[model samples]
Target: MTLFRQIYALLFVLFLLIVASIAYVQFTETQSFLSKQMESDINNASHSLGLMLVPALEAGDDVATETLVNVLFEGGYYQQITLTWLVDGKQQVWTNDIRVTGVPQWFIDLNLFKPITKENVITSGWLQLAKLEITAHPGFGYHEMWRIISNIIIVFSILFLIAILFARVGLGMILKPLNSLSEHAQKIAKRQFGPDMPTPKTTELKELVRAFNSMSAQLKQVFSSLDEEVSALRKKNLVDHVSNLPNRQYMVSRINGWLSEPSSGALMLIKMDWLEDVHSQYGYQIRDETIKLLAEQLHQQLDEISPSVIARIAAYEFAVLIEESERDLLTRYLQCLIRTTNKEISKAGCKPNERFNIGIAERLGQMTVTDILAQADNALQRSRQDNKVFHWFENSQQQLFSREDWRVKLTEAINDKQFQFRWQPVMQLENTEVSQRELFCQLSIQDNMLHAGQFMPFVEMLSLGAMLDRCLIETVAKHNLFERNLEPIAINLTFQSISDQDFHVWLKQFLQNHSTPERVCFEIPEASVYSDLLSCEKICHIIRECGAKFGIDHFGRQFGSMTYLQNLRPSYVKLDQSFAFIEENQHNSELCRALVNVAKGLDIEVIVTGIQEQEQLARFSELRLDAYQGFIAPPEEIKLG
Candidate 1:
C-alpha cells in the first residue's frame, strides 16, 4: 500500500478506539449518577408514603391506604410498593408490580442502572403502625442514559469524519514532492535531461531534489562534451581544412559504401590546372582562397541534389558524386557547374578554358570504387589531350530499359500485382533468435526478377513511391504476415510516401484493420529523415498512434546533428553498411563506438548491417549492439498464400 493509505488507516483505527473509550466512560458515569439519584428518590418516597399512611393506619382505614399506594404505583417511577399491618399478624399488604417503560429492551437488559429499594418504619403518636417498602423503576434511568450516550456517539462520528478527510488531504500534499522526484529519476534513466525540479517545502525532500538536479546537469554536460569530441575528431580526419568539404578519405569510404548496394550514379573530377601557376605567380594564400571560392560555388550549385557528395580529393583536384543515372539531369547539372566555375574563374582574372578540365564517369553494372576512379582518370587524360573543356567516359553496356519503358513496366507491375516478397531475419546477438524480418520486394517481369535497388530510383524519380508503398502494405496485410508468425516485419518507407498526407491516412486505416499492429515496423532512410524531419516525425507519430513501430535505416550515414534522435526516438536504428568496415581503420572504429554510445544512451536499439563475415560480427560484438543483419545467412523468399 501507499504510505498515505497506510498512515490514514492507522489514524482511522486510533480515532475509533478513542471514540469508543470516551463513549464507554460517559455511559458508565451517567449510569452511576442515575443509580445514586434513584436510591435517594426511593428512600424519600418511602418515608413520605409511610407518614401519609399513618392517618389511615390509626383509623384502620384500609381503603384510603390502598388508594394512596395505587396512586403512587401509577406514577411509573417506582417498580413496586408494599404496606403491611404489624399488630394483627394478618398482613394488610398493598403491593404494586410494574414494568419499566420509555426505553428499549436491549438497553434495559444491559442493567446499567440497578433497581433501588428503600424501607421505612411508620409511626403514629409513638405507635408503630406499618412498614413501608418502595422499589424505584429503572425505566427513567435507562431512557436518560440512552439519550446522553446517543448524543455523544453522534457528535464523535461527525468529528471523526472531518478528521479523516483533513488527514487524507494533508498526506497528499506532503508526498507530492516524492512523486516529482520519481518522475525525474525515470527521465534520467532514459538519458533525457530535462529542466531541474522545483525544490519542495519539506527540508529532506528539498535537499534530495537539489542533489538530483545537480546530477542531471552534470550528466548533460558530460554527454555534450562527448558529442563535441566526436564531432571534432570526425572533422579533423574526414573534412578538408581549406574547402571545408569532405576529404579524399571520406569520399572513398562513401563510394565503397554505395557500391556495396545495387545502386547507380556518376562521378565527376575537376582538375584545377591554374592552381600551380597561381601559387608560383602570387602565393599559397591566394591559391587557397581561389580553391575555397570554387568549393563554395560548387556547393551552392549542387546543394539541391541530395544523396550527393562533394570532396577535395587532391591538392588541385575536386570530385563530385551524384546518385543520378538520368543522362538529361546529369547533363543539366554539368552545364550549370561549368557556368558557375567559369564565372568564378573570370572573377579570379583567369581564362575559363585554360583554368580547368572536367572528366565524367557513369556507374555501370557491378563496378567497384577503383573501377569508377580509374575510368574518370582516363577520361580526364583524354580531355586534356583533346584540349576540350570536358569529356565523358563511354561504356559499352546499355540499360535494361529506357525511361518510358521503365515507367510502363513499373505501372504494369503495380496494377497487375506482379511482385514477389522476400525477407531477411535480423538476429539478436545474445539469443541468436530472430528479432524482426527486413522485408524486400522484387518485380517479376517475364522470366526475370529485379530487386528494389534496380528500380527504386526510377520509382522515386517518377513520383510513384506513394502508390508502390500502398500496394506493398495491402499485399502484406492481405497475406496476414503477422498472424502466420510472431516476428515483426520491417518495411522500408520512401520519402515520397511519408511526405504524402493521403498515404498517411491510408497507412492509419491499414494498421487499424490489422489485428496485430505491433508486428509492423516502418523504416525510413536517415538521409530522407534529415531531408524532411518534420514530415518524417509526423509520419512516425501516425505510425505510433496506430500501435505500429518506426525505425531509421542507414542511421550514421548523414553528417547532420544527432539531436533528431532525441525527438523522433525511433524503436531502433540500423547502422549504415559502411560501419561493417570498422575493423579496417581506427577512425572507423572510434566513430562506430561513439555512434553506438549516443544511440544506446537514449535507450535506442542499435543494429549493424552488412555483416558478411564472422570477423565483422566479432568486431561489432564489442560495441554491444542489439542485433545484426547481412549475408551471414541468405535472405529467405517468403511465398504468399
Candidate 2:
C-alpha cells in the first residue's frame, strides 16, 4: 500500500472509535437531562394543581377537582395523568390519560437511554387529598434521544472528513522529499542522475537526500572505475597480436552487434588493393606499417561521426563499420582511411615516393555488418582487379533489397527454424595463451552463411528483428552446445529484443522452456543499451538474475561520456580496430601508450584480438593486458577466420 493509504486507513479507524464513543456519551446525557427536566415540570404542575384543588376538595366541589385533573391530562408533553384517593391508608387511583406507544423493547432496554415518568399529588394545604401521576411518552423520549445521537453523529462525521482531507494534504507536504528521494533512487539506478540532490521540506528528509546524493556520487566514481576496467578488458580482447588490428573474430562480433540496432548511417568494408604487392616488394614491416596507418587514419577520421571498427578478418583483409551516414561521416571518413593512407606512412619512416595501390569497398545500410564488408571487399577486389577507385555494390544496390522481398523471407524463416551459432574463442590472454571460446550466431541455409549482414535487413523490413533474435538464441543454444565445446557463449541481440515491453516475462519463460544460459551468451551490444538506457538497465538487472554475464560485444566505437561506462559494468569490451592496428604497426608508440594508461586507470583487463605476428607481442605485453587473442594465439577453428 502507498504511504497515504496506510496513514488514511489508520486515521480512519481511530475516527470511527472516537465518533462511536461520542455518540454513546451524547445518548446517555440526552436521556438523563430529558428525564430530569420532565420530572421538574411535572412536579411544578402537580404543586399548582394541588394548591387549587385543595380549596375545591375542602369545599366538597368534586366537579372542580375532577376538572383540574382533566385539564392537566390535556396538557402536552405528558403521556399520562392520574388522581388517586387515600381512604384510611388504602389508595385508589383514577387515570384520564395513558402514555405508552410501540417503542422497540430493545431500544427501551438499552442502557444508553430510558423512558421518563413523573408523579404528583393533589392534597389539602395541611395534608394530601389526592395524588397525581404522569409519565413521559416512551416513544417521544426515544425519538428525542435518537435525534441527539443523530446530530452528534453528523457533526462528528463532518469533522472526520475534514481531518482526513487535512491529513492527506499535510502528510503529502511533509513526505514530499521522501517521495522525490524514491524517484531519485530509481533514476540513479538507471544511470540517468548525477550527484545533485532534490530539495526537501523536512530537515531529516533533506539530510537523507543529501546523504544519498553523497553516496550516489561515491558509487558513481567506483562504478566508473570498474566500468573503465571492463571496457579496457573489452578493447583488449579484440586485438591482433602481430598487426595489432582486431581479428576476424572481433570484427564479425562487433559489426553484427552494431548493426543489430537500427543505424542512422552506413557500414563499409575496405580491403588493401595492393596488399599482396606491398608484401612482395616492401617486405613485412612496411606492409604491416601501411595497414596500421590505414587503421589509425580511419579511426582518427571516423570516430567523431560514427564508431568504426578496423579488423584484419583475413590475411590482407580489413573491415570498417560506421553508424552515421553515407554522406556525413562515412563518405568523408572512408576517404581518410584510403586517401590519406600514404600521407601518414611518412611518420612510420616509410618512403613517400613509394607508389601504393588500394582497393576499397563501402555500402550504405540498413545492411548487415558482413554484407557491407563483403560488398566493400567485393568492390575493392573488383577495383584492384579492374584497376579503379573503390567500387560500390552494383546492379542497383539500393533497389536490390526491396522491403517486400526480405519481409517474405523473414516471415518464412521465423515460421521455420533457419539460424545457427558459430563458435569463436574468447582467449583469456594469460602468459600469451588462449583459454576459452565464446560462440556467436549466424543464419545458415544450404549455401550462404548469413551473418546479421544478409538476413537482418529482411528481419527489419519485416519488422521482425526482435522475433529473429529469439529464434537465433533458441537455435544457437539448441545446436551449438550439443555439437561443440561452447562455454559462456554470448549471442548479441538487438536493442529491440531487450526493450520489448514484455521482454523479461517472455524471455524468462523462453529460457525455462527452450534453453538455460549456462553455455549461452545473451550478448547485448553497448550501443543498444546506451540508446534505451533506462529500459536497458532494467532488462540487464532482470537478465543478470539468471546468472548470465552481461557483455557489450563492440565498444570504443561510441563517443559516449565515461560516466555511463562507469555505471554499467559489462563483462568486457571488444576494442576498436583503429587502436588495435595502431598498436600493431606503431609498436611502443605514444598513442598506444595513452590507450594503455587510460585503460588501466579504469581497471579493465586488456584483450588484444588483432595481433598478426609474434613480433607484435611486445607491444601488448607492455600494455599489462589481462588477456590477448589474435593471429599469434589464433586457435584452430573451422567457424572463425
Candidate 3:
C-alpha cells in the first residue's frame, strides 16, 4: 500500500472510534435524564393523590376512596395505586393493578428504567385516615429512551458519513502531491533529470519538489561541461601528431584487422631514403617541412581511393594498407602516390634521390603477419637497389576478393544473420570472481569467423554499424544471458551507431521491453562518445532510464583531461589495451596512473584489459583496478537459455 492510503486508513479508524464513543456517552446521558424526570413526576403525583383520597377515607367512605384510586389507575398514568386505612386497629387496603403497553420488553430491559414508588399519609381535618401509594409506569421513560437512542443513531450516522466524504476530499488534495513526487523520484532513478517539479500548496512538499528540481538542473549542467572536455580529448587521440593522419598504432590495428578477413590485400611501406641526406643539407626545420609536404601530397593522391588506411608509421617511413583485390589497380594507385611525392619534393626544392622509395606486398591467403612484413621489406630493399621509386612483391594468391565482393559478402552476412556473439568474463582483480561477461560481436561468413575489428570498418563504411549493434542486443535478450548466468553483460557500440538518431530511439524502446535491463550495460567507445557529446549524452540518459548502465570503453589513450569522468559518472571505465605494456611503455603507464587516480577520486571502477601475462596483472595489482579482461582468460562459448 502507498503511504497516503496507509495514513488515510488509520485516520478513518480513529474517526470511527471517536464517533462511537460520543454516541454511547450521549445515549447514557439521555437515559439518565428521562429516568430522573419520570421519578420526579411519580413523587409529585403520589402526594396529590393522597390529598384527594383523604376526604373519602376520613369519612369512612371506602367506595369513594376506591373509586378515586380506580379513576387514577384507569387514567393510565400509574402502573399500580393502593389506599390503606386503619379500621378497628387493623389495616384495610384498596389496590388497583394496571398493565403497561406500547413499549418493547427488550428496550425496557436494555434501558433498565423503573418507575418510582411514593407513599403518602392521608389526613382529614388533621386526623390520619389512610396511606396512599402511587407507582409511575416506566413505559413513558422506556419510550423516551428509545426515541433518544434512535435519534442519536440516525443523526450521528449521517454526520459520520459526511465527515468521511470531507476527509477523503481533503486527504486526496494533500496526498495527490505525494504521488507526483513519487513519479519524479522514479524518473530521477532512471537518470531522466527533466523539467522542474510540480508546485504544491503544502509548504514542506513544495520545498522538497523545488530542491529536487534544483538537483536535476545542477546535474545536467555538470554533465554538459564534462561532455565538452571528452569531445576535445577524443579528437586528439585519433590523429597522428606529426603527420595529421591516423597514427601508427591505429594503422597497425586497422591492418591487422583487415588481414583477419579472407581477402586479397596489400601493405605498402614508403621510406624517405634521402630524408637523412636532406637533414644533413638543410636544418631540422627544412626536414620537418619536407615531411609535411610529402604527407600532404600522399593524402591528395590517395584521396580518390579514399577508404584506405594511411599512416606515418615512423619518422622516416609511411605505411598504407590497400584491401583491393586487383593488383593492377593497386599498382596504379602506388605509382600515382610516388609521382605525387616526386612532384611535391620538386616543388619543395629537394633532390630526386630524396623523393621516395616504396615497397608493396600482396596479402597471401592465411599467411602470418610476420611473413607479409618480411616480403614487404625485401621488396623495399629491391626498390632501393634498383634505384626505382616503386616496387611490388609478386601476387601469388589465386583467389582475390575485390572491394565490391567484400561489400556484397558483408550485406549477405547481415541479411542471413550470419553472426555470433562470444562471452569474455571480466573478473574482479582482488577476488578473482567473474563479475560480468563482456560481449564480442563477430561476423561469420561461409564458416569463417571474423572479429569486429576485421569487419567493422566495412560495416561502418556501409552504414551497417547500427544494424550490427541492434543484432547483438537482440541476441543477448533472446539468449536470456542474465537469467542463465546471473551475471551482467555488456555490449559495445560504435561511434556511427551512437551518433545515429534512429538507433537511439530504437534502443530506448528495446531496453524498456528487455527482461534484464538492469543486468545489461552498454559500452560506449570513449573516442566515439566525444565526437558528438550532446547526442551521446541524451542517448546515455535514455539507456539509464531503461535501467541499463553505461561504461567508457578504450579509456586513457587520448591526451586530454579526465574531467568528463567526474561529470558523466559512468558505472566504470575500461582502460585500453596499451596500458598493459608497463615495462616498454612508460608514457602509457603514467597515463594509466593518472586515469586511475582520477577514477578513484570519482569512485568509478577502473577495468583493465589485455592482461595476457601474470606480470601485467601484477603491475596493475597495486593500482587496485576493479576488474581484468582479455587474453588472460579466453572467451568462453555462451550457452543459450
Candidate 4:
C-alpha cells in the first residue's frame, strides 16, 4: 500500500480504539455514580417515611400506615415499601414491579445499576413505632445510565468522523512532498529534467527534496556535458577548420548514404589550383580568409536549392553534392556558384581563370562513392585541359522519366491506390525479437516497381508527400497489418507531411478510428526535424497522444544538436545508413558510438540501419544498439489479409 494509505489506516484504527476506551470509561463511571445516587435517595426516603408513619403506628391505625406506604410505592421511585408492626409482631407490605421506559432491554440486562434496599426504624419520641423497609427501582437508574452512555457515544462518534477527515487532510499534506519526489524521479527515468520540487515542512522530507533536486541537476549537467563532448568531437573530426564546411570524411559518408538509395543527384568538385599561389603570395591568413569567404558564398547560393552538402575535401579542392534531379536547374546553380566564386577570388587578388576548375558527375544507378568521385575527377581534368571553368562527366545512360513524367506517375499511383508497402523487420539485439517492422512504400507504374528512394523525392518535390502518407496509412489499416503481424509497423513521414497541419489533424482522426494505435509507429526524418523543429515536435506529440510510437529516421545524418532528443524523446532512432559501413570507416564508428551514447543516456533506443553484413552488425554491437534494418534481413512484401 502507499504510505498515505498505510498511515491513514493505522490512524483510523487508533481513533476507533480511543473512542472505544472513552465509551467504556464513561459507561463504567456513569453506572457506578447512578448506583450510589440511587442508594442515597432510597436511604433518605426510608428514613423520612418511617418518621412520617410513626404517628399512625403510635395510634395503631393500620390504614394510616398503609396510606403512607402506598403513597411512596405508587410514586414508582420505590420498587417495594413495607411497614412492620413491632408491637403486635405483624407486617404490612406495599410493593410495585420494576418497569423501565425508553431504554432497550439489552441496556437493562447489563444491570448497570442494581436494586438498592434501605431500612429504618419508626420512632415516637425515643422509641420506633414500626420498622420501615424500601427497595429503590433499578429501572430509573438503568434509564438514566443508558441516556448518559448514549449521549457520550453519539458525541464521540461524530468527533471520530471529524478527526478522520482532519487526519486524511493532514496525511495528504505531509506526504505531498514525497509524491512530488516520486514524480520527479519518474521524469528523470524518462530523461526529462524538470523544475525542482518544493521543500516540505517536515525536516527529513525537506532534506530529501533538496538532495533529489541536486541529483537531477547533476544528471542534467552530465547529459549536457556528453552532448557537448559529442559536438566538440564532430567539429574536430568531421568539420573543416579553415572553411568551416564538412571535411572530406564527412562528405564521403554523406555521399555514400545517398548512393545507397536508388536516387539520382549531382556531385560538383571544385579544384582551387590558384589557392597554392595565393598562399605563397598572400600568406596563410589571407588564403584562409579567402577560403572562408568562398565557403560562406557557396552556402548562401546553394541554400535556395534542395538539400545539398558543401565540403572542403582537400587543401585546394572542395566538393558540393546537390540532390537536384533536374539538369537545367543544376547547371544554373553551378554557373551561379562559379560566378560567385570568381568574384570572391578576384577580390582576393587571384586570376579568375586560375581560381578553380569545376567537375560535375551525375549520381545514377548503383554507383559507389569511388565511382562518383573518379567520374567527377575526370570531369575536373577535362575542365583544366580544355581551359573551361566547368565540365560535366558524360554518361550514355538516360533517366527513365522526365520531371513531369515522374509527377504524373506519382499522381496516378496515389489516385489509383497503387502504392505497395514492404515490411523490413528490425531485430532487437538483446533477444533477436522483431521489435518493429519498418515499412517501405513502392510505386507501381508502367510495369515498373520503384523503390521509395526512387519516387519519394518526386513525391516531396511535387508536394504530394502528405497525400502519399495518408494513402499509405489507410492501406495499412485496410489490410489489418497490425493484427496480422502483432507487431508495430513504422511508417516514414515526409517533411511535407510533418509540417502539414491538415495532415496532423487527419492522422489524429485516423488513429482514433483505428483501435490499435500502439501497433503503428510514425518516423520523422532527422533532417525534417532540423528544418522545422516546432512542426516535428507538434506531430510527435500528436502521435504519442494517440497511443502510437514516434521515432527519428536518419538520426545522425544532419549536423544539428543531439539535445533535441531530450525534448522529442522518440521511442527509437535509426542512425543514418552511412554508419553501417563502420567496419571500414573508423570515423563513422566513433561518431556512431557517441551518438548512441547520447541517445541511450536519455533512455531512447538506438537503431542502426543498412546492416548488410555480420561484420557491420558485430561492429555496431559494441555500441549497445537496440535493433537494425538492412539487407541482413531483406524487406519482405507484407501480404494483405
The residue ranges of model 3 lying beyond 4 angstroms of the native Cα positions read: 1-35, 45-400, 403-421, 440-456, 465-484, 488-522, 531-552, 556-573, 582-590, 593-605, 638-641
Pairs with steric clashes in candidate 3 = none
Q: Considering summed lDDT, which 10 consecutive residues are worst modelled in model 4?
A: 580-589
What order do candidates take by lDDT, descending?
A: 4, 1, 3, 2
| Candidate 3 lDDT | 0.72
How much lDDT does each candidate structure score? 0.83, 0.59, 0.72, 0.84
**Residue 97 lDDT, candidate 2, scale 0-100:** 46
Candidate 2 residue lDDT tens string, 160-241? 8899889889888887777778878877665554658766767767778888898778766765655565455445565775
lDDT of 1 by residue, 67-182 (tens): 87877677658877766687775455444555555667887788777668888878877788887878787777888887887788789888988898898888889988887888
Sliding window of 10 residues with minimal summed lDDT for model 2: 352-361
Model 4 stretches astray by more than 4 angstroms: 56-67, 74-111, 117-135, 161-176, 195-202, 262-264, 324-332, 394-409, 582-588
Candidate 4 residue pairs in clash (backbone atoms < 3 Å): 122-128, 122-129, 123-128
User: 1-641, model 4: which lDDT tens digit per residue?
Assistant: 98898999899898888878877887788778888888888877887787778778888988887887777777758888777788887988777876788999987787666678888887787775677778888987878887887788789878988998899888888888888888899999888998888888899888889999999999999999888878877888789999999998888878888888656679999998787888999898989988998889888877776568999999999999987366877878887888888888788777886757999999766688899999999999999999898999999888789889988878888878898878889998988889999888877778988787777767777899899999988888888887887789998888789999999999999988888899999988888888899998899898888899999988888886788898899999998987775345666567777888899898899898988878778887678888888889998986675
Q: How well does candidate 1 match the true structure, expressed as C-alpha RMSD? A: 3.7
Off by over 4 Å in 2: 1-6, 13-25, 59-63, 87-106, 109-121, 125-128, 134-140, 186-195, 228-296, 300-308, 311-338, 345-523, 527-641
Candidate 3: Cα lDDT at 2: 80
